[model samples]
Target: MTLTAAQTVAALATIAGSDNVVGDPAKMGAWLYEPRKRFHQSAAAVVTPPTVEAVQAVLRWANENGTGIIAQGGNTGLVGAQVPLSGNEVILSLARLDRIRSIDTAAGVMTAEAGVILENAHKAAEAEGSMFPLWLASQGSARIGGVLSSNAGGVNVLAYGNARELTMGVEAVLADGRLYRGLNALKKDNTGYDLKDLLVGAEGTLGIITAASLKIYPLPEDYETALVNIASPEAALELFQLMRQRAGARLNAFELIPWIGLDIQMRHGMLDRDPTASASPWYALIELSRMAGTAPGALQSSLEAAFDAALISDATIAESLADRTRMWAFREQMSECQSREGASIKHDVSVPIAAVPALIGQGVTAAETLVPGIRPVPFGHMGDGNIHFNFSMPVGADPKAFMAEFDEAVHAVIYDVVLKLGGSVSAEHGIGQLKVDLLRQVKDPVALDMMRAIKTALDPKGILNPGKMLRSVP
Candidate 1:
């Protein structure tokens, strides 16, 4: 009953017009090219459904034909979730379904279709005198469906929660082509079996998210921004606690960056000028959101108290909008600046707040032991205990050889420490094709069984995003 690639394309074109189906590899660059360029297999065809009913119809046909379908949005995902795994799968993109259903400022909720860009959603919320707090560097291209499916976490997670907490309900097409309409603006609902929660972070395995009802917040009047100089991660941790006590929910961001980040930026001439005060071994970028009536200087007062407590050595408060922009650019550009140095190994992991220092300490030591002279660049949401633990290769090592030799073993060493500290291996980024085997090795057996059961109950034919987030090959 297996159809050839040509037959698959023809059938898909029949469901959604011929122009909507892309079988030619040359014209499929946008859908095939992922952020990391990790998963490069060819899809059977890329189908763009223009309407909700069309999406349902395509899914119904694919399910009956036993064709693997991968739900993709924006194609800006880091873990290859939006691209193809097996060559036989067809990619169903929600790009043409872009629409904002409704926005209610009083209710503090907005229902947007899946293909709507994250940045567009922000503008819609702002137009209504509110804010959608899920801000990411890739927001310009990332779509709401991909963000919710990954359950993305970004810079402002300290104040607002991740995508799962921000989203109230979702409307998706289940594996059997049935629509599950769970959209509502209520803050509290105690229904049987939390299906909305199940599909949010499922990475397109259970179903295809078409639209969502998301929470919104009042726009802050301004932000109190500053860059504090700390001697080490331990001091940064202490300063973080002090800021939490002073600002509480208003503390929007607390990001940790080592001095190496500044060095790379300066050498590459990426910045017009240095954004910090002189130079220091470590820095923490902190910001406090000011409400409509609240006065400024809250972050300044908090820093003064930290200085008095010897938690911080020096700090620079942003006096103007330009200063604030420069400070944020410095923190937000950490990931990109790494490429200027050379090849690097990266891990997006999290641990308990108190165990962060230990995690970084052990991770650096272990990596250096394996690859001598590997420079560690550990930075990210310090308050959230999520660190982007990355290590640049030695000065003269070849990138390909280094990755080929040390990638697997290095992961083993770092993950061992993370698991010991009761942390998650994949924090903000979901497990796409990247960590399927690792999840099998590291995840709890009971949790794995539950996930498999749920996957089976929903996608009995395994036609929805097959071989994603699960150890199917094993």
Candidate 2:
């Protein structure tokens, strides 16, 4: 039989002392609330394990009792993965496991606990004269565990790669409470199946990550940042090709933004001043890293070539630190500025780099066709072809009414375009509670069966993050 809520809380408290378990709903606000405010179910209790052994003990108890356990990091995920789905699960918050176990610059790896904040990891790497390049908007609060669990990709992915690429190894507690010590600083280990890759993006359905050895790189001397105006997505794509040809690995970021983003931010006072060169239909925020021995005029020379080719109309290159910060601030605030316009339906989807322009064009057409007055605000990592396809409600429309009427319909239309373009429904964000049904509908049948088989093999009791990435097997 299933345990009662009180019994679950008491069991968790026994595993991780009374001081570490919070059973009161009032005190569970921090763990209950997610970034999107979409998942609001309260957990039976929130457990903060003080040590790796404590995490193992808690998992062992939960597995034996058949209680659900949801592993959470900083609670900053856009999806509902970190929050409770059933309200009876115990939230395993890794907040107490915060630590920087080691940073070996020569070895080019840093070992960080799951609870260590992303920004703190960045600072630690910088202090050691190296860098961890996985930068997201929620770096201040997003923890290493959740970041790896979701396999997050941010602006710098063009140069470095996503969380999965940056992670060298992981240490996790399995569903049955056995510890998998996979941490290593080696450049290669073709020992067997890559278990680290499996747990990194499993969304806590497979295991609870405790710590990881992340790849670090030598810090670049400086960055050449600019915001350039382009005529359309096609023009932006051509200019991106030019950048890649010229800068190669030094090309750090190439983000695309629509005019609607600029209008929304300016109207809402989200930016102190305009970061672009002039008003245009679209913008490409580009940046290139300048190493100590490398020259700084590469970006300027490339922009001149782009200008000659008519790929870009105008541009504003950052001449100072403040200018660079303002440029990035505009790019980073794209998601937040949408709220100023009212209700918005959003998709974090990706296509091949060459198909980004077509995806945006077709997606915008579909969205506008579905909702006559819906405003398209498609933008994001253009180099990687991951666009944050969003649509603002018609002018003066009721946010509740708009969402109720068109949320699902809009998703269908946009996802249709994405799939047709050989793209994925989710790009950077992982499938949590939000995309469970969608994944079932769109994912390949054979692939789904394989996923289920692996999930069953790893977590037979369906205890770790039940009903998350994949639905619980009936």
| TM-score between model 2 and native | 0.99
Q: Taking the tens digit of each residue's C-alpha lDDT, what string does model 2 give over 1-474?
A: 988878887888887899999989999999999978988998888999999999999999999989899999999888799999988899999988899999999999999999999999999999989999999999999999999999999999999999999999999999999999999998979899999999988999999999999999999999999999999999999999999998999999999999989999999999999999999999999999998998789999999999999999999999999999999999999999988889999999999999999998998898888899999999999999999999999999999999999999999999999999999999989999999999998999999998999899999999999999898764
Output the lDDT of residue 412, model 2.
Answer: 95
- Candidates' lDDT values, in order? 0.91, 0.94
- In angstroms, the error of model 1 at 424 is 0.8
How many Å off is the CA of 337 in candidate 1? 1.3
What candidate 1 gets wrong by more than 4 Å, as runs, is: none
Which candidate number maximizes lDDT? 2
Candidate 1 residue 15 Cα shift, in angstroms, is 1.2
How many Å off is the CA of 350 in candidate 1?
Answer: 0.4
lDDT of 2: 0.94
